[model samples]
Target: MNIHIFQHAPLENDTGAINHWINKGNHKKFYTRLYADDPFPSIDSFDFLIILGGPMGTYEEDKYVWLIKEKEFIRQAVNAGKKILGICLGSQLLADVLGAKVYKNNKKEIGWFPVTLTPDGRDHALFAGIENSINVLHWHSDTFTLPEKSIRLLESEACVNQAFLYETHVLGLQFHFEATPDSVISMLESDSESLSISSDSVQNSEEMLNNLHYSGKSNEILFTLLDRFLAL
Candidate 1:
């Protein structure tokens, strides 16, 4: 399969597990580094599209001019029936493109937090092997309402819209299941200021670093979901 990634930031890209999965499958990989003015690829070029996370909010088109173009491309991809997965800010962008409202959550969740699968999520084939509730990395302040014809998948104490599935091909996840230890370290280094804020949902650098083991399970879940999603 030809996999294309829309990377929003240098620090937040594909994790080791995702790279291994692509290599193991001998899939062709492509990228559009929107942060560096990388041009978007034609929708016909890739089978699967993965949109990675970033610190920016989806509503910040004024500051990030590329957002407008990115949204247009995403809309085109959706209309073309492409299989797309969006994480964090990527998910917010997807929601906005689908005509959903994206805005700040009441609290910023920036740590390893437990999100329970909704009844729909629990019964969904994509999460067949995953537990009902699992801890995943959360580093977003923005959340979105579910898009039209989308099913709510996961929910957490800090955020109600943890994940959603749209039209069987498009998915939007509020948390980070693709986080590896190195990726977490890079996130800490690049956005250290977010941790300085006093919030019950935010974890300190040491705390996040100490919970690196969580990545192992998270990655396993991500792999399973990816496999099932592709099979769908």
Candidate 2:
């Protein structure tokens, strides 16, 4: 399969597990670095599209002009029947593109937090082998209302809409299941100032670094999800 990625920041990109999955499948990979004003690929060029996380919010189009174009591109991809997976800000963008309201949550969730699968998620094939609840990295202040016609997949105490699936082909996850130890460190360093905020949802750098082992389980879940999603 030909895969394409839409990356929003310099430090935010695909994890090692995702890269390994692509290599193992011998898939062709492409990218559009939105931060650098990279060009987007034609919709028909890639079989699957992966959108990575970033610190920016989906509503910041005035500051990031590229966001306007990117949303339109995502809308186009969805209309074209492409399989797409979105993480963090990417998920918020997907929600906005699908005519949902995106706004700040009451609290910022920025740590390894437990996200429980909703009843729909429990029966969904995408999360077949995964546990009912798992700790995944959450680093977003904004959340979105579920898109019309999308199934709510996951939820957490901090956020209600943790994950959603739109028409089977498009999936949006509010947390990070593809984060590696190195990627976690990079994200922490990139937005270290946010750590100083006093909130139960936010974890200190040391605390987050100590729980790097969680990524192993998260990565396994991610692999299973991707395999099932692609096979659909």
Candidate 3:
């Protein structure tokens, strides 16, 4: 399989946790680092496209010039029937490109949280092995409305639209199922100001580090989702 990843920042790129899953199959993986001004690939260049998360908001096109082009590329990829995965900000971008409204949630989710799977998510083929409610790492404050023709998947206490399925080939997850200990640290280091130690929805750096085991379980669920997604 030919896989392409769109990374919004250096530290927030694909981590070893996801590498272990995607590397299981015979695949050639490529990257387009929008933070570094790397050129976007042609839609036909890859069979699958994975969009990684970043600190930037989806609507901040004036501050991040590449975001506009990135959304367009994602839209084209979706239309082309490419199997795609979008994480956090990538999910917001996907929702925006698909005509969904992206906005700030009432609370920012920045720690370990449980996501309850919707009825469709529980019965969905892509989430075959995933449980109805699972604790996953959350670092995003923005949430999106479900796109047209999309099935709502997961919901958390702070975010209603935690995950969504756009057709059979497109998946968007608000939480970071692919987060590793290192990636979590990188995120904290890069955007520490966003963390609120006293907030009900946020966890401190120490708390985040101590609960690294949650990431392992999340990654297992991610692997299952990826396997089922690729099989289709």
Candidate order by lDDT, highest to lowest?
Answer: 2, 1, 3
Candidate 2 has a TM-score of 0.97
Score each candidate by Cα lDDT.
0.90, 0.91, 0.87
Question: For model 1, how does the per-residue alpha-carbon lDDT over 104-166 read when each residue is reduced to its tens digit?
Answer: 899899999899999999999988867999999999999999999998999999999999999
> TM-score of the candidate numbered 3?
0.95
C-alpha lDDT of candidate 3 relative to the true structure: 0.87
Highest-TM-score candidate: 2
Instruction: State in Å the error of residue 91, model 3.
Output: 0.6
TM-score of 1: 0.96
Across 33-71, the per-residue lDDT of candidate 2 in tens digits comes to 999999989888999999988888899989999999999
RMSD of each: 1.1, 1.0, 1.4
Ranking by TM-score: 2, 1, 3
Q: What's the C-alpha lDDT at position 202 in model 1?
A: 97
Name model 1 segments beyond 4 Å from true: 14-16
lDDT for each residue of candidate 3 in 1-232, tens digit (9 for 90 to 100): 8989998887777554778876787688999999999998988899999888888899899999989889888989998999998989888989999999999888889988899998888888877766788988999888999999999989998889999988889989999899888888777788888785468889888888888889888998888888887787
Give per-model TM-scores: 0.96, 0.97, 0.95
